[model samples]
Target: MELITLLLLACALAMDSFAVSITAGLSLKQFNATTMSRISVTFALFQGLMPVIGWSLGTNFAAAISRYDHWIVFALLCFIGGKMIYDAIQQHEQAHCINIYSKRTICSLAIATSIDALAVGFTFSLLEVDIVFSAFIIGLMTFIFSFAGLTIGLKLGSIFQRKVEFIGGLLLIAIGTKVLITHLLT
Candidate 1:
C-alpha cells in the first residue's frame, strides 16, 4: 500500500483502541503518563501483532478464500463495530470494578478490542499491501490515539465516552458496509 493509504488504514484501525482508552481514562481516578503509556503500548502491540498473526494465517488460507476476502473483512469489521455500537447504546451507567491496568483485564480488553485488526491483517494478505509498514503505522497511530484518548477522558470526563464509542463503532460498520456494497456492486 502507498504511504497515505497505509496511514488512513492505520487511523481506521486505531479507533477501537482510542475508544477503549477513553473508557479507561474515565474509570481511573487520575490519569498519569505511566498509565497512559502502558495502555497505549498494550493496545499498540496487540493491534500490531494481530495483523501479523492474521496475515500469516491468511497466507495459508488465501487461495481458498481469495474470492471472498472482501466479504470476510466486511463481516469481521462489521461484527466488531456493530457490537461496540450496541454495547455503547445498551450499556448502563454501572460501577465497573475491573481495573484496566491489571494484567488479566488488560489482556482480555486488548484482545477483545483488536479482533477487527486480525481480520484487517487477513485482508491485507489478499491485497497489494506492505505488511511491515502497515502494521507499524497502525501500531503508531493506535499508540498516539490511545494516549490522546486518555487525556481527553481525563479532561472532558465521561461525557463523551459513550458518544465517542457510538461514533467509532458506527464509522467502522459504515466502512465495512461500504466495502461490502462496493465489492458486490462491482
Candidate 2:
C-alpha cells in the first residue's frame, strides 16, 4: 500500500488503542510517568506486533481468527470495563484502585484493543503489502494516539472527577460492542 494509505490504515487501527488508553488514564489517581510510558509502550507494541503476527499467519488461519476474534475482544473489554464500573461504584481505599498500571491489566487492554489490527495485518498479507512498514506505521500511530488519549483522559478526569471511571467504563463497553457489531455486520 501507498504511504498515505498505510498512514490512514494506521490511524484507523489506532482508534481502539486511543480510546482504551483514555479509559486507562481515567483510572489514574495521580500523574505518573511510569503509568503513561507503560500504557503507551505496551499498547504500541501490541498494536504494532499484532499486524506482523497476522501477516505471518497469513491466509492459513484467517477464517478461524476472524470467526472468533470479535467475541474474544468483546469479552475481554467487557470484563475489564465491568470491573472498572463496579470498582468505581464501590468504595476504593484510594479512590482509584482499578490497577491500570498492572502488567496483566495493561496487557489485557492492549490485546483487546488491538485484535482488529491483526485482521488488518491479514489483509496486508493478502494485498502483498510491506508488513514491516505498515506495522511500524500502525505502532507509531498507536503510540501517539495512546499518549494523547492518556493526556486527554487525565484532563477530563481532573475536570469531571469521581465519575471518570464510570464514564470510561461505559466507553470501553461501547467500544467492545462496536467491534462486535461491526464484525457481525461485515
Candidate 3:
C-alpha cells in the first residue's frame, strides 16, 4: 500500500482511540502527563499489536482465500467502517466512563478501540504491504491522535466525538471502495 493510504488508514483506525482519549481527558480533573501518556501508550500498543495478530491469522489462511482476497479485503474494511458509523450514531446516547487509575479499564478501552485494526491486519496480510511498517504507522498515529484528543478533551470537552467517528467511518468506507476498484481495474 502507498504511504498516504497507510497514513490515512492509520488515522481512520486511530479515531476510536482519539474519541476515547477525549473522554479520558474530560475525566481528568487536572492535567497529568503521566496519566495521559499511559493511556495513549496503551491505546497505541494495542492498536499496533492487534494488526500483527490479525496478520498472523490472515497469513495462515491467505493461500486459501488468495483467489478472492481483494473482495474479502473490501468486505472486511466495509464491515468495519460500517460498524464505526453505526457505533457513532449510538455513541451520543452513551456516557464516557474511563478510569485513568485503573490499568484494566485503560487496557479494555485500548482493545475495544483497536478491534478494527485487527481486521485491517487480516487485509494487510493478503496485500503486498510491509506489516512491520504498517503496524508502526498505525501505532504512531494512534499515539499522536490519542494524545491530542486527550489534550483537546481537557480544554474542549466531548464535542468532537460524533463528528470524528462519522468522518473516520466515511474515510474507511471510501478507502475500501478504492481498494476494490483498484483491484478490479488491474
lDDT of candidate 2 over 1-186, digit per residue (tens): 558657655765666667566666787767888779879989999999998988887657546666676776677556656765775576544433446868998898889878867766765665567888888888999999888778877777533333545664565566567667876997
Worst 10 residues of 1 by lDDT: 91-100
What pairs collide in candidate 3?
A: none
The CA lDDT at 109 in model 1 is 76
lDDT of 1: 0.77
- The best candidate in terms of TM-score: 3
Q: Give Cα-based local distance difference scores for all models.
A: 0.77, 0.71, 0.90
User: Clashing pairs in model 2?
Assistant: none
Order the numbered candidates by TM-score, best leading.
Answer: 3, 1, 2
| Model 1 residue pairs with clashes | none
Question: Which parts of model 2 have CA positions greater than 4 angstroms off?
Answer: 59-98, 158-186
Each candidate structure's count of clashing pairs: 0, 0, 0
TM accuracy, model 2:
0.64
Model 3, which residues run further than 4 Å from truth? Answer: 92-94
All models, RMSD in angstroms? 2.6, 7.5, 1.1
**Model 3 lowest lDDT segment of ten:** 91-100
What TM-scores do the predictions have? 0.83, 0.64, 0.97
Give the per-residue Cα lDDT of candidate 2 at 96.
38
Better of 1 and 2 by lDDT: 1
